[model samples]
Target: MKIAIIGTRGIPNHYGGFEQITEQLATGLVERGHSVTVYNSHNHPNVAKSWKGVSIQHCYDPEHMLGTAGQFVYDLNCIRHARKNNFDVWLFMGYTSSSVWHSFFPKNSIIVSNMDGMEWKRTKYAKTVQRFLKYAEKLAVKHSHFHIADSPAIKDYLDKKYSVNAKFIPYGAVLPAASEEETLRQYNLAKDDYFLLIARMEPENNVEMILDGFSASNCKKNFLVIGKTENKFGKRLVGKYGSDNRIKFLGAIFDQETVHALRANAQLYFHGHSVGGTNPSLLEAMASGSLIAAHDNIFNKAVLGNDAFYFDCAACVKALLEKTVCTETKKTFTRNNTEKIRQQYSWDKIIDAYENYFFECCQSAKNESYVSSKRWACK
Candidate 1:
């Protein structure tokens, strides 16, 4: 099937969850003898002309004020391309941007939209943007032939808020590259020596809270946070926390091997995302066999299982620190849970799920298009 994937920064996946999923899924589909084209942002310098047997269509847009509007501009360009491509299916990865394209595409086109978290609820957007997002989200849900929710929490949110039925498919992760010894040596630390936090340093991710909590912790272990220096929030975080050598802030790590090594060998993985569905980083850490200490959200709990430790604030940190080695039963449970994640959340399982969804949407589209054409001919 000819598939067009829309709504992301672009193909090489230097950035976020959607891009990573797009890269892996596109490659996997290509290997399975499906023709896939990923719409990429020309603004991203590292994006190649082509990638992994998939065509990368570069969509150009001016950098206006830099944020949601910029995204909309890029997405509009992608939609223009999507309308021209005549793809068997258009798989939209984001909520706010792709829904607007529904009016442009064939109504019978296999439109599958991923209801990626509640974008309106995110703290980053302004009141006007939030209002627009709420509308776009509604249209995306209302128009799509199929909807994908990355976690049960997201699926439930859509069901409750939008009264829309969405299929739940969790994100997958690859294992880390760094060996236990090498991982420890690279960081110049023993196992469990540092509290590691991996996330985009955005307000929604609770970056400040993570830093403050670690600083407030009387625990012996140092804190190591990894993320991209994206905006003012990141700058402020660096200014506040980066000065402390103990609070090592590694910014924007692109090398997967290095990231995996750090994640896999960390004494503990600190997941600070207060919002969003099944985080790819947290899942990757689990796949890497890191002892998980995540924010106690439903999404995190659902992913980590009851075996993992959860904390909301400084007091929670004190409890987590005190219970570290004493919770051998918890460790054992988490280890077993890791094995489960490795099996269930593997790339193979995820790719297969995507393939099935694609084909199903494509076939449905074909049937509906045929019926529409027949009616037009009769008229």
Candidate 2:
């Protein structure tokens, strides 16, 4: 099957969850004897003609100049290219802007969309913009031949909201082996001496609440935050909580090995994302064998089960920090989560599931085509 992957900044993941999964899925598909083309943003840092065995097609994206509005233009450009190429499937990773172009999609291709979390519910956008996103989401569901949900919570939401069944394909993470703490030396850190939180700087991520709780805690260990502090929300957080000596803001680190090392060496990894399903960071934390303290929500509960601690506010976090977490307990949590990951979130299993679904959709389309031809002959 000829597959075209659209709706991300580009692959080799300079960004977050979608890009990471896209790179994995595309490369895996190619290895299984399928032709795959991944659309890339012209501004992607590692933009190349091809990476591994997957083909890369760069499109015009002016997001740097026009901000969010430029994404729509980029998606439209990709759609135009896909239409001319006659792909059997167009796998969209997100529909933030492309859903509006549902009518323009080529008739010959099947539309399989991954319905991301409730993007419209994010607190970062204005009310009007959020409303627009909600509308866009509806259109995406209406037009897609099939949709994918990464978590049980998300699958339930779509089933309730649209009364439609979607394919449940969660993201996967690799278990990290212990590596040298070369990156932590720069921040004056050592193994298991600090708490860590790594995520994008956004309102929905609850960076302030995590910092507030860490600052108020009686624990003497440092709290290391690994995200860029140049955003408005990030700057405000620094100004408000910068006085705490125990808190350290180490700006964004994109190196995967360094990220794994940081997670592996931390005493605990805090995840405060309240708006997404199956967060990549959370999976990474689990894979690194780190004890996790995630936000109190269905999404977090669904992933961590009994292996993690939960917190909803600064007070809850402060209280949890006061206790002495024993090594035996940490070891048990790590062992349990590691087993769970192997059983449910392995990369090889995820790749196989995707390939099977893609082939099933193609086969279904062929069957329908055969029936339609017979009906035409009878007429």
Candidate 3:
């Protein structure tokens, strides 16, 4: 099958979850003997025509200059390109900006949209923006041939709200080995010496709350906040807790190997994301055998299950830390989480699921095309 993947920054994945998933999915599909083309942003640092056997097509993205509005134009450009490509399927990763053009999607290709977290419910967006997002989501649901929800909770919500049957297929990750001692030394980090929080310093991520709770804790380990500190929320977090020498705000480390190393050695990995389903970072932390203290939400609960320590507020973070400093020393959670990743969330199984879905959709599409042709001939 010839598949065209859209709605991501690029393949080499200097961006977030969608891009990472696209990189994995596209490359994996290509390796499985399918022709896959991943649409990229022209703004992406790497401008290669192809990366690891997957074809690349760059579209103009002015997010750096126009901000959120630029994404709409970028998606338009991708849609234009996709319409001309005549691919068997178009896999759109998200609906944030692309849903508005849903009606313009190529008629020959079966459109599959991945329903990412409840974007409208995110706390950061304004009321008007949230309403617009809801409308866009509706359009996506109505126009797409199939809905892919990364979490069961998301699938259930979409099914109830739209009265549509959406497929539930969570994101995937590879189980990581132990951290390299040399990699740990580069950051002056040691095995289990620090608690880590790796996420964009956004308000929705509960970044400030995590820092506040850590500051409140009497625990001995350092709290390392990974991700960029240049944003307003990040800078505000620094101003509020920067003086607390215990909190180390190690800004965005993009290298996957480095991130896996950090996760492997962390005493505790705090996943405070409240917006998304099956977060890539959370899976990475689990794969690396990190003991997790995730925000208690249906999304995280579904992924971590009983293997993680849950927290709802600053007090909860403080309590979890205090416990970890003492009796929470057992490696049972880490062992169980790693096993979960190995058994359930491996990328190999995820790619197979996608392959099976693709072929099913393709065969259904062919039958529909045949029926449509017959109707036209009779008319």
List per-candidate RMSD values in Å: 3.4, 3.2, 3.1
- Looking at candidate 1, the ten consecutive residues that score lowest on lDDT are 370-379
TM-score of each: 0.90, 0.95, 0.95
Question: Roughly what TM-score does model 1 have, to 2 decimal places?
Answer: 0.90
Give lDDT tens digits, candidate 2, residues 355-376.
Answer: 8887776676667651122111
Per-residue lDDT for 1-379 in model 1, tens only? 7788988888687788999999899999889888899988887765676777898898885554575567777888888877776577788998676677667766535678888888888887789888998899889988777889999999998889878778888888886555557656776877656778888878878778767766766767778878876578888888887666778877778777777777765667778787778888888788777777888788888887776778887677656765646557646956876786778788888999988877665565556563133222100
Clashes (N, CA, C under 3 Å) per candidate = 2, 0, 1
After the best TM-score superposition of candidate 2, give how far the Cα of residue 72 lies from its true spot, in angstroms.
0.9
Native-vs-model 3 lDDT?
0.86
The Cα local distance difference test for each model comes to: 0.77, 0.87, 0.86
In angstroms, give how far residue 54 of model 3 lies from its true place: 0.6
On the 0 to 100 scale, the lDDT of residue 44 in model 1 is 72
- Residue 221 of model 3, lDDT score: 79
- Rank candidates by TM-score, best first: 2, 3, 1
lDDT of 3 by residue, 198-264 (tens): 9998888998888889899888778888999887778888899968898998888888788899888
